[model samples]
Target: MRQSDKKASFIELGKFLSQFSEKGNHLNPEVKNNDRFFDNFVSLIELSQSHNGWFTPEQVYFSVQSWAEALTESNLDQWLSRYDFTNITSKTVGLILAGNIPLVGFHDFLSVLISGHKVLVKTSSNDQKLLPFLAEYLISVTPEIASYITFTDGKLENFDAVIATGSNNTARYFEYYFKDKPSIIRKNRNSVAVLNGKETKEDLVNLGEDIFRYFGLGCRNVSKLFLPKDYDFKLFFEAMYEYGDIIHYEKYANNYDYNKAVFLMSRFELLDNEFMTLKEDTSYASPISSVFYEYYDSADTLKTRLEADKDQLQCIVSNAVITDSIPFGKTQHPELWDYADNVDTLDFLIKI
Candidate 1:
């Protein structure tokens, strides 16, 4: 299939996804294959939590809405405009997806196909339903796309190159396994926020979205905070109160109770607000229902530390206190070109 045809099919898939939202499902008569796919898609969204306890309707819908906004003609054109596909030879690229958040690996899948290559996807068992369902929709829109996409349940085989996402442990195995193939192997990384005491209430409230979105399951979620010395937790806690209802969910509440108890027993000082706890720590990866914070004396020194640990971080959220840091609350709403782990996935696919 031509690249234009693949882009058109994805745009159609985006339109189809635009119909479902947390507010309500609105069917558009003009969307192709809705009669065959729309109702079933709604049912799948409702049943997503059963497949994975973390895949709540609200979280899934947020992901759907984010993608609906991303896969537009303008966004696609702008993202793809930077690449040259003239001399490309189509090759099969295997994707081992991660299921931490809904459609976590969709970008890689989209990248391989948009670069005019076949995609052999091994969907994470936690996210097996959504992508394949959309793939079926894509094939329905452009029949040729069927030959370009495949899903395998067993070991991946017969692929020219590979892109895989996993934890640090599994990444080691992937490096050894795909030793000879061109590859991008990803591992666990966390996002952090650098804060000065002068943040407005609105800014901090938006930061709550970065902290609490998807229950902090995604690599882009802010799991750590860098605060100035003697930083006041009162306003920060007040801003976070906007998301206090997150504790109402059984899974999150359980994590809150358990992690809080573990901290209390360890005699660590905690700043708590009944729903989530704030602890003083240096680690970037924090448990669900908790956020770790550290005190920084110098912005220059902190920047140097972050730069030294760039590979361990995915995003740095701030209000321009740190150079190249993303704005508050926007970590989960990454653009098409905001490649994960700062790796250029399209360039990798094209070269392979």
Candidate 2:
């Protein structure tokens, strides 16, 4: 298919996705594949929790809404404007997706296809349903797309290059396994927030969204905080109270109980609000239902530290308090140009 055709199909896919949301959902009759895809997608959204307990309709819909806003023609055109696709070849790109939150690997899948390459996807077992269902919708809208997309359950084979996402351990294996192929192998990276004591209640409240969205399962979710020395967390805790109900979920509550117990047994000081725990620790990758924090005396020193550990970070949320840091609550709803790990995926795909 031509690049224009590929872009048009994704823009339509975006419109189809725009119908579903956390508060409301409606199928637009004008959408090309709605006759067959509408009802089935609603069923899949309902069945998503059964497939993976984390894929609740609210979270799934949020993911859908984010993608819907992102895949617009304007966004696609602006994001792709820097690339020249004239030299692109129709090579097959193997995609080993991650099932962390919803559609975590969709960007890579889109990148390969939009660059005029075939995509051979191996869906993460945790996220097997949603992407394939959408792929079917895409093929329905643009029949030519059926020739460009494939989902495989077996080991990936016969692909010129690969994009894989996994934990650090799996990354080591991917490094050795795809040694010869042009590839993007992602590892576990977490986002962190740098907070000054001057933050207003609303700033801290929005920060809660950064922490609790996706139940802190996504790499973009803020798992840690850097507080100014002697900063009181009373306001921060008060603001985060809005998300206190997250503890009602079995998985999050289980993690809260387990991690809190482990911390208690280790005699670490913890600040608990009956739902989430705040601990003074240096780790960037905190467990669910908990956020680790560290006190810094100097912003310059901390900025230097963050720069030194950039590879361990997916985002740095602040009031632009640190260089290149994103504003609070914007981490999860990244723009198309916000490449993960600062690696330009489109550049990788085009070159390969």
Candidate 3:
């Protein structure tokens, strides 16, 4: 199929997605393939939590709406215009998606097809429904590309290359198995925030969205905070209080109960506001319903440490406190070009 046709199909898919929201799901009769996909997708979003408790309607709608904004014709054209497609070669690219967040690995799937390569996808058990349903919508939009996408439940075969997302441990296994084939293997990494204690209440409240969205299951969620040596939590906790209703969710409340009890039993120092707990730790990955924090003496010193640990970090959220840091609450709304692990997926696909 032509590149224009490929881009158009995805843009249509985006328009279809634009109709859904946490408040409600609306169908625009003008969007093609709505009859086939619209109502069924609403039911699927409602049923998502049964498949994975973390997939609440609010979070699922946020994910759906974000993609709707991103997959516009202009955004897709701008992202694709940077690469040359004159010498393209088609290959089967295998994708091992992560289910930590809704539609987490959709970027890789989009990249392969846009680059003129077919894709064989292995959806994470945690997220199996959404992508395939969208894939069917794409085929309906452009039936000529029906053979371009496939989802497999068993071992992947007849694929020329692969892209896998998993933990640091599974990365080891992927390295050994796909070592002979060209691949991009992603590992576990967490995002962090740096606070100078001058951030406005609004800034901290937006930061709460970054921390609490997806119930803090996504790698892009801010899991750790770096504060000045003697910074106060009065304002931070107050800002976070806006999301206090999160504890009403049974799954998150259960985690809050269990992790807090463990911390109390261990005699560790903690700051609690009923819904969440804050503990001082040197680690980056914090448990659900809890956030780890550390004190830093100097911004320059923290920059050096972050540079050395960039491989283990996805992003840094700050109000320009650190260079190249993502602003508060924007991590979850990444553009099509914000490749995870700082790797250019289109470039890799074009080469293979």
- Tens digits of per-residue lDDT for model 3, 1-352: 8889999999999999999998788879899977778889999999999999989988889999999999999999899989998798888999999999899988999999999999999999999999999999999999988889999999899999999999999999999999999999999999999999999999999999999999999888999999997898999999999999999999999999999999999999999999999999999999999999999999999999999999989989999999889999898989899999899999998888
lDDT of 2 by residue, 154-200 (tens): 99999999999999999999999999999999999999999989999
Could you tell me which 10 consecutive residues in candidate 3 have the lowest summed lDDT? 33-42
User: Model 3, residue 210: displacement in angstroms?
Assistant: 0.9
Model 1 lDDT vs. the true structure? 0.95
lDDT scores for all predictions? 0.95, 0.92, 0.94
Ranking, lDDT, top scorer first = 1, 3, 2
Residue lDDT tens for model 1, 1-352: 7899999999999999999999999999999988999999999999999999999999999999999999999999999999999989999999999999999999999999999999999999999999999899999999988999999999999999999999999999999999999999999999999999999999999999999999999999999999999998888988999998998999999999999999999999998999999999989999999999999989999999999999999999999999989999899999999999999999888787
RMSD, candidate 1, Å: 0.7
In model 2, what lDDT does residue 183 have?
93
Segments of candidate 3 deviating more than 4 angstroms? none
Please give the TM-score that candidate 3 achieves against the real structure: 0.99
lDDT over C-alpha atoms for residue 236 of model 2: 92
